[model samples]
Target: MVFRPPFEEFEIQLVEVPAGETVPAPTNPGPLLLLVTRGAGSAAASGGAAASSKLLAQAELRRGSVAFVPAGTTIKYTASGAGDLQVWAAAVNAKVFAPATAEEAAAAAEPALVAA
Candidate 1:
């Protein structure tokens, strides 16, 4: 997955996982923050097991859950049901790695004098 980090802003990524598919390993060791927007699923890491292999996070996420993935922790995911598993994920210090900037606008044209 690709995350876009804005200037003085957080990096964001939308993930949609099919049933029986797990999220890939972490390419980097960073703090991951996920917010469920659509479907639900289970998540885990090197420290613990997923929440539920069939349901979503009805209550608070456990330590091994996706919400508790600490820094330097290797992360992965597992789909719950046939429905999709959609989430919004972000990382800490994303802006530090790569930041965004605004583009400058062009100047207005000047009017010319004409003879009658």
Candidate 2:
């Protein structure tokens, strides 16, 4: 078994979503893989206005749940109960150092993840 990437520029983020709080992370530049390691919660991918956004996808997260977040999508992690929710997020083909662009901003503003 072997895995190969065109370039080796990615990030593995150890995220902790506190109990009963919504945390907003920056828009991902590439595909993202998420795995819940502890506690319970839900991962939501949304786009559009902040006042009234639409959910692209919602996945129930547990101790061993997995979710996929696409590029140019904004994801929010929320923890339930009294303990924090921990998850490991791995971004592939990620351009973490790239500057933000107007097109990118607009794409993020009107995100729509389609399932095939």
Candidate 3:
């Protein structure tokens, strides 16, 4: 579903992935914040310039799990476990927020998944 935010600089989407399904990797034009609200899954980022296939992060999704993906990063998501994966994702312009630290920058550079 489409989500119209109070501000025009961003948008949110409700995404669902069937159990045992995977979504192909795709690059986004802006930063994306994905919050898993149900079920379980993993989101991975494809190695970029080096062409390496490495997992950036993984989590057993449940309510409040969050994943931050920076702009232009290619990401692949898989839905596993016993039920379908449901997530609330928000895409925001990268220019809107500035990384405050090296760690934050590093985290934002790849797929940083965290369980809540």
- Give the candidate number with the greatest TM-score: 2
Model 3 spans > 4 angstroms off: 47-60, 93-116
Tens digits of per-residue lDDT, candidate 1, 1-116, equal 65664553556767677766877655334566777665556665553222232232222322233454455555565667666676667766555554334421122133356578
Clashes of 3: 0
* lDDT of all predictions: 0.55, 0.74, 0.70
Worst window of 10 by summed lDDT in candidate 3: 47-56
Model 1 residue runs over 4 Å out of place are 47-66, 93-116
Who is ahead in TM-score, 2 or 3? Answer: 2
Writing each residue's lDDT as its tens digit, candidate 3 over 45-110 gives 654421343444444566679877666666666888789888887887333554558886787788
lDDT of 2 by residue, 41-82 (tens): 887776532225444467788998887776667778889758
**Candidate 2 — which residues are off by over 4 angstroms?**
1-7, 48-56, 96-116
Q: Please, what's the RMSD in Å of model 2? A: 11.4
RMSD of each: 11.7, 11.4, 12.8
Worst 10 residues of 1 by lDDT: 54-63
